[model samples]
Every structure is written in structure tokens, then in C-alpha cells.
Target: MIPRYTTPEMGEVWADTTRFGRWLEIELLATEAHAALGVVPDADAVACRERAPQTDAAFVAAVSERERITDHDVAAFVDVVQAAIGAPAGSWIHYGLTSSDVVDTALCLAMRDAGRLLVSAADTLIATVTDLATTHRDTVMIGRTHGIHAEPTTFGAKAALWALQLDRDRTRLRTATETVAVCKLSGAVGTYSNVEPAVEHHVAEALGLTAVPATQVIARDRHAELLYACASTAATCELIAVELRHLQRTEVGEVLEGFKPGQKGSSAMPHKRNPISAETISGLARVVRSNLLAALQDVALWHERDISHSSVERIIVPDSTTLVHYCLQRLNRLLGGLVVNVDRMRDNLWSSRGLVFSQPVLLALVAAGRSRDDAYRIVQRNALRSWEEGVDFRQLLENDADVTLTPQQLDEAFDLARSVRNIDRVFSELHSMASR
Candidate 1:
């Protein structure tokens, strides 16, 4: 992912230093496990541990320099670490282990940490959206369907729906994190031909991961699931962004993204306050979704294990995680400072005259001894006139003798309160979920 859409914390999780550091940790843990099993001498394991080089810039550069010659990253890393440990103990550094043993385990560690950051950002976003929802619970607005006014709804109700989706996204992130929190040290053929199963278990436990049965590499299905979860979360962010962008449209003007004092919406236009944040989120979501396709493709590699997934993972894993983390944080800020135009919302709600209350009016006529079809025809006639001529629907109905409804009945039918009377019920459900 580019720096523009990457958070520093998430970027660091995939950094060379962090990757190499995890590799070294896995090696040391495996060495200790071997020593416990009496496969490697205790003294050699201690020397290997105590003499291991610090995984800093120097170490990373050395590994890169070695990789150029070996043309194998894991092999080069092993060579570099062996030299740093030196002598008799250095030979035991990666004994009874294949590249996947260390590489896959280290990848899991990185993913676990990166996932934590994403989940935390999602938590903050959920809170921000919930706050907005609660604050706007009674802030009435028009609901649109297919770009046409449908009925009255509160901004809070819309925000509450978003909050609920975000909550689901958070759950998905956590589930994906656990799905990938697994280590496989079954050797080149996954049969543990040389490395004992106990050694794998010890290292996995030390790293707070589970040792799972696998081939040379951990199954790509696990990776695919993680990527799918990220893509799903990104899609949720895009969902919210798209709605916000629609609300912020010039014609609508019901909501606006927060604009910093000096921020310019356009280089040429001074009167614009564009929803750039939401637009950015919607755009980045496509990238994450594309990455997920790549991950799914990775699941069908050649035979038990192959490097076909390796190069793709190097890009997709970090990019997806980083992009999602960035999107979530950006959305949080966007919602936290969102500018809701309550008066504009109210005005927009009635922009179609009284046509929004057509359904209620139709039902009222039906209750007044009219056939359902007859009631619908009566309501549609007046609703169309109100829509086309900019006349109040109720007045149009009152003037139509076939309407067959008394004034009191008409008043009860067009009541806006009836449209949102159950809004409190929705909030009650939301509050109950929050408590749990």
C-alpha cells in the first residue's frame, strides 16, 4: 500500500525489521525445543540463542545482500543468522527445519499483530458511529429509494444501521485473526520427517499460536479467509462512504464531510466542500477487494506447497491490512466530525409535498370501506398531482370527493410521527446489543 493510505503502526507490522525479528525469534524457539528433545545439545542451543544477532538495519541489509547470491530469501536469512551466531552452535540454528517452518510461522505473528491494530481501529469507528446515531435518534430526514423520496426516517436510524454493520466488521476481523493464528513446522513434505511434532508445538506455544497439521506451508485457505475478512470490512466502510457521499451531494445537502479550516475541496472552486474522505475510502475499498481475489487464487497452488502464493502474499497481505486500517481510521475521523444539516434534512423530507405519506393515506382509505385497489388508485391519483404540480397531497385529497376520507382520518393518515414512532424501538434494540 502507498504511504498516503497506510498507517504507521500497520506499516511497521510488515516492515523488514519486524519480519526478520520474528524469523529470529522462531529460530531461537525451535532451537530451544530441539535442545529440550535432546536432538541438539543444550550448550549449543544456549550459544545459538545468546549469540544471535539483533534484527536491525544491519541485519536486514546483510540478509538482502546474501539473498542476492542465494536467490532464496529464507535461505539467505538462515545463512546470515548462522554466520552471526558463528562456529559449532551456528550450524544448529535452523536444524531440522525447512524455510516454511520459519517463514509461515513468522507470517502468522505479523498477521496477528496487524489484525490487532485493525480491530482496535474498528472499535473506535463503531463508537463514533454509535455516538452519531444516538445523538441523531430524533433528527428526522427523508428516506430515499432508487434516488426517489420514499418516506420519513431519522438520520440516527441510518447511522445506527451503519454502527451495527461496523460491529459485524469488527467480529469478522477478530475471527480472521484467529483463523490465521496458526503455525506449521511439518518440514518439506509436512510429514515431520526430521523435525518432531513436539518441536512444532513448543515453538507454536511460545509464539502464542496453534500448531496445525499442514504441508510444507500452512494452507492458503487460512490466508484466503483473512483476506476475505479484510475485504468484507473494507466493503462495509465503502457502504458507509457511499451513503455519506450521496447525502453530501449538492442537490441533497443533508450532510457534509468535515472540512478543515484550510482544506480546499477543489483547486479551482472555492465554494465546494466535497466528500473527499468518503471518496478516498470508497476508492481504496476496491483495492482491498481485488487483493482478496488474488488471495483466493493463491489457495489452488501446485501440489502440497509452492511459491506461487508467496510473491502474491508479499503484496496483498500487507496492502490489504494497511488499507483496511487506514480506511477504518479515516472513516472514524470522518464520522466524528460529520456536519449534519438537521433543518436541511427536515426541508428535504417535505420537498415532495405530502407524497411521502401516500402509503398511510392509502391504508386509511382501505380502512374506510374502500377496496385495496380502489384505495391505492385514489392515493396514487392525488400523490401524482402533488408530485407533478408541487401541491400538498393532503389538500389534493381533501378536494377529491372520491377520496372518501374525513378530515380527522386524513390528519391521522399524514402524521409524520407515525412514520418514526418505532424509532425508539430500534434504539432500544441497539442499546441492548451494546450492553451485551
Candidate 2:
């Protein structure tokens, strides 16, 4: 990942030094495991493990520079580590291994570590949305469909829906991460070739991973699964951002992302307060989703393997992870200090002049012995009249000859509390699910 999108903790996970260091650890573990099985000398294993810590910035840079000439990163890395060790003991390093044997295994560990960070970021986003939902549980607002007011609902309900999506996203992501957290160290064409399966198991266990039988590389599907998880998470973030953008619109004005004092929304417009964070999330989500294609395309390789997936993954993995990390952090901060307009929410509920109450009115009329079609017709007639003339829909219903609803029934139909009567039970379910 580039520095611009990287956070310190996550950045370290994908750093060249950390990457090379992981490679060293994998090689050292294999040597130690091989020593136990009499595949390598005990003295050599100890020497390599003692020298493993020598992997630092200079050594990593040396490997990077060496790759410029060798054109093979894993080979370059092996050479650098062996050179640093400077002994007959270094001869045991990377024995009986192809580049993918070490590269793919090390990559799995790096991906797993980075995945945990994404999961943590997702968990934080879930908590932030939960807080907003609980805080605004009773804050009544108009609900819309097709960008038109449809009914009354609490702002908390909207927040709860977003939380639900993230919860599902996190579940799918956790599963995918586990699937990708596997090590493959079976030689050039896999099949264990010259390396023992037990040695692979021992090394994998030492790295806190599972050993999976592979063909030169751990399956590309595993890599694609992680990318799919990221794309799914990005999809969820976009859903939330889109909702925020709609609520924060200049005309709607029901909510606003936090705009610090002196924050500029525009260069020339003095009163502009844009949904910049939400818009940012929306735009970056496209980038994350697009990476899914590259990952999926990497699934098909030439024979046992090819370098096709390698170059694409080098860009997508860190970019997708870092972008998602930035998005989660940005969104959490945006919602934490969000400005919700309770008064404006109430105002917008009536912005349609009681058309939002049409369905409830229709239901009450049906309960009052009117036919369903007759009730719908009456309600639709009143709603259209209200929309065209900006008149009160209730008065139109009151004056209608076809309407069978009494005054008390009509007023009850228009009651905002009626739309939210079952909300507490819904909130109860959300809270219970979250607790688990």
C-alpha cells in the first residue's frame, strides 16, 4: 500500500521489511522442522534461527535492489538472507524449496495478519453504527422509497439496517480470512516433490497457520476469496455512505457529517457543508470493487502456475486492504460526531403534506368495511390532490364521499406513533443479535 492510504499499524503489516522478515521466519521454521526430522543438521538450524533477526531495512532494501537484476524477488530474498548469515550454516536455508514454496507460504501469513486488522476495523464500524442506532432509536423521521417520501420511521431504524449489513459482512469476511490463512510449502510443482509433508505441517503450525496441499502455490481462489471479502465490505460501506449522502443533501438536510469549525466545503461557496466523507467512501468503494475482477481473473493460470496472478496481486492486495482500512476509520469518525437534525426530520415528514399517511388511511378504511380497491382509490385521490394543490390530505379525506373512515379513525391513521409501535421489539432483536 502507498503511504497516502496507509495507517501505521496496517502499513507495517505490508511493509517490505516486515514482508522479508516473514519470509525469513518461514525459511527458518522449515530448517528447524527439517532438523527435527533429520532432513537438515541441528547446528545449521540453530545458526539460521540465530541469524534470522538480521532481516532489517538495509537487508530488505538489498533484496529489493537485488531483485532489479535477478528479476525474481523470492530468489533475491534468499540470496540476501544467506549472504547476511555468511556461513556454511546458511547452506541449510531454503533447502528443498522452490520460490513459491516460501513466497506463497509467507504471503498467506501476511494476508492473514492484514485480514485481522480489517476485521477489527469492521468491528469498530459496527460498534459506531450501533451507538448511533441506540442513541436515535426514538428519533422519528420520514422513510423514503424511490427518492419519494413513503412512510414514517425512526432514524435509529436506518442506522440499525446499516449495522445489520456490516454484521453480515463481518461474518462472511471472517470465514474468508480463515480460508486464506493456509500455508503451502510443497516444492516447485507441489506434490511434496522432495520436501516432506510433515515438515510443511510443522513449519505451518509454528507460523500459526494450517498446511494445505497445493500446486506450486496456494490456490488463487483463496486469494480471490480475500479480495471478494474486501469487495463485499466495500459494498456495505457504500450502502451506508449513499444513505448518508441522501440524508445530508442540501434539500433534505436531515443529517450532516461532522464538519469541523473552519472546515471548507468549497473554495468559493461560503455556506456549503458537503457530505465529503460519505462521498469519499462512495468513490473509494468503486476502486475496491474493481479489484475483485483482477483477483478473480488470477484464478486461471498457465499449467501448474504462472506469474500472471503475482503482478496483479501485488497491487490489489495492499491497495484494497489499505483503502478499506481508511474507509472504516473515516466512516467511524464521520458518524461519531455526526449532526442529526431532529427538528428537520419532523419537518421533512410533512414536506409531502400528509401523503406519507396514505397507506395507513387506506388500511383503516379497509378495516372499516370498505373494499381494498375502494380504500386505495380514496387514499390515492386524496394523496394526489394534496400533492398538486399543497393542501392538507386529511381535510381532503374528511371531505370525500367515498371514504368510510370516521374522524377518530382518520386521525389515528395519520398518527406518527402508529408507524413506530413495533419498533421497540425490532430494536430488542437487534440488541440481542449484537450481544451474541
Best by lDDT: 1
Residue lDDT tens for model 2, 78-140: 888888776898878898889898888888888898889989998998999999999999999
Q: What lDDT, from 0 to 1, does candidate 2 have?
A: 0.88
TM-score of each: 0.98, 0.97
Per-residue lDDT tens digits for candidate 1, residues 205-237, read 999999999988898888898899899999999
Model 2 segments more than 4 A misplaced? none
The lDDT per prediction is 0.91, 0.88
Q: Number of clashing residue pairs in every model?
A: 0, 0
